[model samples]
Every structure is written in structure tokens, then in C-alpha cells.
Target: MRITELIDRTTLFDRILLVFLLFVTGASIVLIPLYLPHGGQIRIEVNNKLLYKLPINEDKTIPIGGLTVEIKAGKVRVADSDCPGKICVKQGWIDSGAIICLPNRVVITVEGTAAAPKGVDATT
Candidate 1:
């Protein structure tokens, strides 16, 4: 039978309770992410080793090996690198995701307050 038929068979209080529960579930799904704090720092790594967990709020330039990462106004970009492709530099500034240079083995990731996965040295 249809879900509406089942609801119709229930008493008024039961129907109201079910509706309230559904509303709560839906609200939580929509609001939880909005309330979660955005990541305030950039996690930099090279060859799977933690390099830096610098705050994105302050503009800075970091030189990790042959790669130069520039952080400005809460965003980061691969300003320069010795890698041949230069794909990492072309990716542009980003507030999230990652800017990875395979040749130089440099990785920059933006994360929220959530902790990085276990065994991963990238997040500090």
C-alpha cells in the first residue's frame, strides 16, 4: 500500500509525531553542514610528510622543497614550482580541495574543523 494510506490509518497524534520527526530529520540534514566550522588553515605536505598547517587568515608564502605556495586572503595557490607540467600552478587559488604537484610531491589541502584521517600526516 502507499505511504499516504498507512499515514491515514494512524491516529492523529501518531501522524503528527511522524511529521514532526521527518521535519526534524530534514532540518538536521540541511543545517548541520551550515553550522559546521569551515577550515581555517591550510595543510601542506610533501612526500606524505606534514610540512605546515598554517592559518589561511594570514597571507604567507611557503617554500617546500622546490614548490612555492602562496596563501592570500584565506585562499592558496601554487605560486611556483620546479615541476615541468606546471599543472599545480595553473590550478589557481582555492579555498578548498587540494593543489597537488606530483613531480615535486607537494600537496596542499583545505579542511574544516574536522580532523584529518588517521595515519595521514598531512593534517596537523
Candidate 2:
């Protein structure tokens, strides 16, 4: 009827296994983020064409059409844009994923060595 009663009914071996599993889960939560790969480069595309491939380590501001992209401290963001909604500019700095300015036909993506393998569903 109660959690304590259920736990008390568990054998010593079961308790040990539960503790081990908890430890493993905690370790995974802490360690997984550390091992995950970080973006190494920023790719800028215009009109579905590759426009620039810049290193994430270097800080720079790029101007394309009416949009201004700023990269700083290994992060990239759309600092300014002429788009009506300003959604891209509001998205702020990002270390991973992409920023799209639909009106300007611009897309910015962060890429790294751990990119999805060829022939695999990257979205997954």
C-alpha cells in the first residue's frame, strides 16, 4: 500500500541492483553532456547555396543583404535583420542547431565532427 512497504519487501540483491542502477543513471546524466561533441564551424547559406564556412572559435560579424550575423565566444546569432517579424534576431546566440531568416532566404547552421553518418536519418 505504501512505497516504504514495497521497498522493504525487496531482497538485498534487489536493493543492491537498484543502488547500482541509480548510480549509473546519475553518472550518465552528469557525463553524457561532457562527452557530446560541440560545434566546430558555422555554415552560412543563402538561397540554398553555401555562402560561408567559418570557424566557431573566431569571433566575427558578417553582413549579408540586410541581415547581420555575429559570432562570439564559439556562439553564433543574428544580431540584426531587416525581416518583418525579427524572429531570427530574437532567437539569440546558439552553440548548436540552426537559425533561419525566411524572408531573407538565409540559413545558419552549426556543424561539428560528430555530424550524423551518411545515409542515416539525421533528424532522428
Best by TM-score: 2
lDDT of 2 by residue, 22-122 (tens): 99999988886566446688889999999999998899999999999999999999999999999999999988778999999999988885455778575
Q: Give candidate 1's whole-model lDDT.
A: 0.84
**TM-score of every model versus the real structure:** 0.61, 0.62
Clashes of each: 1, 0
Q: Candidate 2 clash total?
A: 0
Shift in Å, residue 37, candidate 2? 5.3
